[model samples]
Target: MATGFYTHPDCVLHEMGEWHPECPARLQAIEDQLIAGRIDGLLERREAPLVAEADILRAHTAAHWDFLSANAPKSGYFAIDGDTVLNSHSLTAARRAAGAAVAATDAVLAGELENAFCSIRPPGHHATPGTAMGFCLLNNIAVAVRHALDVHGLQRVAIVDFDVHHGNGTEAAFAGESRVLMCSIFQHPFYPYSGTENPAPNMVNVPVPARTGGLEVREMIDLTWLPRLEEFKPQMIFISAGFDAHRDDDLGGLALTEADFSWITAQVKAVAQRHAHGRIVSCLEGGYNLSALGRSVVAHLRVLADL
Candidate 1:
């Protein structure tokens, strides 16, 4: 089966501001690169459905959902934080972003697709259950992982977050849960600097110093993440795919390149093949520089689509 490419049009309709780094153009950049690289035709594309309230509640509180929806700005933007904002279409877009993750999970587990990639966002990974931060309003990957564990009856699922910043929100969701093993590598003392502090036994969080290069990142993953993943033997693998770690992206000071992203995807792909019957679901989290983001996603998808 072809790899599933999940996305939605409403995701592009929600905008924070004209100059925000996490603009709707980020999605357009991915779309352009996919067409330019000819990877668009190699995959199965699908529109994302809006998430049900129950799905969002699997990882977030009802009050959290109620607040975001109730407080959505009708004409302008409602500031959730110094950075996170909600416009008329913000909640709708967030629902689609999260729904993409869930639908992709269902598709992968049901064998409708070998694996799936969700290209929707108001990028998720940073929003905790009760707090929305780091330009995230809803924790998309968390909702999907819970869907896999709760609805699909998967006993064990592994979450791999490779964002430049720590996935504090995702960590908050499943920190002590035995059924989930969360492995990550992020720039230390960075934004949402919380991963290094007493992580749970199931968490393998490697915090690299600023300006760390791709080779060192790979070595850390090999030394830290791989062994734990092997031991856990997850029934499904979910990736919080973020490209802001690329050297060209100024949001992060890391020195990773598109090749590094591909290498990481390949490593995760091998793990999935070995332990999860090749079932994997990936959701986009962050990647600011348009050119770098688009190129990096294409590199990652090449490995997934075997192009």
Candidate 2:
């Protein structure tokens, strides 16, 4: 089966500001690169349905929903935090971004697709149960994992986050939940610097310093993430797919290249094939540099699609 691609037009309508790194153009860049690389044709495309309130509540508290709804601006932008902002279309876009994850999960588990990729954003992974930050309003990957665990009756699920910054929100949501194991690598002393300290027993958090390259990432995953994932033997695997660690992206200092993204995807895919019957749901996180983000996503997709 082809890999599933979930996205929506509303995702492009939401904008933080002209100067923000997390712009709607990021999606366009990925789409353009996919076409240019001839990778778009290998996937089954689907429009992301708006997420149900109950699904959103799986990963976030009702208070978080109420806060975003109450603060959503009617015309201009509202600042949720110093870096996160909401415009008139932000709520709708965020909902669709989350919905894409849910849809991808359903499609993957139903055997309609081998695996799926969600290309919607304001890139989630930073928003916690009650707080939205780091250019994220909803924790998309967390919501999907919860749906897989609760709604689909899956007992074991693993989340692999490789964003340049720590996935503090995702970690917080599943901290003590033994059913879920989160293995991740991120730049140390970076934004939202919190992963290097004591982590939950279920978490395999690796803090790679700046200027680290693919060799370090490979070693970390081979030595740390793979073992935890093997022992957990997850029924499904979810990825917090962030490409900001690419050398071209100055948003963070890691010097990874497109080859690294492909390597990581291959590693994750092997884990899925071994333990999860090849079930995978990947959602976009942080990737700021337009060209590199586009190219990196295509490389990752090539591995996922096995093309």
Candidate 3:
């Protein structure tokens, strides 16, 4: 089956600011690289819809939605936290970002596609049940995972987050939910600074130090994450595909490369093939350096599409 690529133009309109690293250009960078690599034509393309209020409520509180709506400016930006901000197009773009994940889940579950990639922003995994932080307004992956379990009647699902920063909000959302197993690798003592402490049993949180590279990442996956994931035997797999760990990205301190992204995708793809009928849904999270983000996404897609 072909891989589904879900994105929306609104995603490009929600700019934090000219100086913010999470600019609208991130989406364009990914597309530019895909076209340059001659891989854009290989996948099925689809526009991401606006997610339903019910779907958004599944992962976030009504109060959170209310706050975002009330604070959405008509022309300027509203600061949600130190780094996170909401402009006029923020809500629409956030809804579409979450919507892309839900649509991708539906497509993969229906066997209309083998898997999907949601190239969206502002990146999620940092936004929590009642709070928005880390440039995220909605927990996109959490909403989709809930939809797969609650709406689709999926028994077991797994979320793999490889962002340089821990997915604190994702961990908070599914902390004790045995039906979902979250495996992650992030820089320790980094932004949000909370993954080193106690974690839920189902959470395989690996906090690698700064400057850690591909060899260590592979070892951790083989020795730690793979075992738990195999035992979990998830019915579906989701990825928080963050590329900030790339050595070229100054936003993060890890030393990962584009080759590392490809290697890790291959590993996760193998896991899906072994246990999940090759069903996977990947969402964009954090990759600030435009060039590295684009190159890394190409490598990731190449593996996901089995090219």
Count backbone overlaps in model 3.
0
Q: Rank the candidates by lDDT, best first.
A: 3, 1, 2
Kindly provide the TM-score of model 3 when superposed on the true structure, using C-alpha atoms: 0.99
Native-vs-model 3 lDDT?
Answer: 0.95
- Runs of candidate 3 exceeding 4 Å displacement: none
**Residue 2 error, candidate 1, Å:** 1.2
* Per-residue lDDT over 25-52 for candidate 1, one digit per residue giving the tens place of the 0 to 100 score: 9999999999999899999998999998
Give the Å error, residue 256, model 3: 0.4
Candidate number with the higher lDDT (2 or 3): 3
Error of 1 at 207 (Å): 0.2
Error of 2 at 258 (Å): 0.8
lDDT of each: 0.94, 0.93, 0.95
Candidate 2 lDDT over residue span 1-307, tens digit each: 8899999999998998898889999999999999999988889999999999999999999999999999999999999878899999999999999999999999899999999999999888999988999999999998999899999999999999999999999999999899999999999989998887789899999999999998888988899998889899999999999999998898999999999999999999998999999999999999999999999999999999999
Of candidate 3, the 10-residue stretch with the lowest lDDT total is 189-198
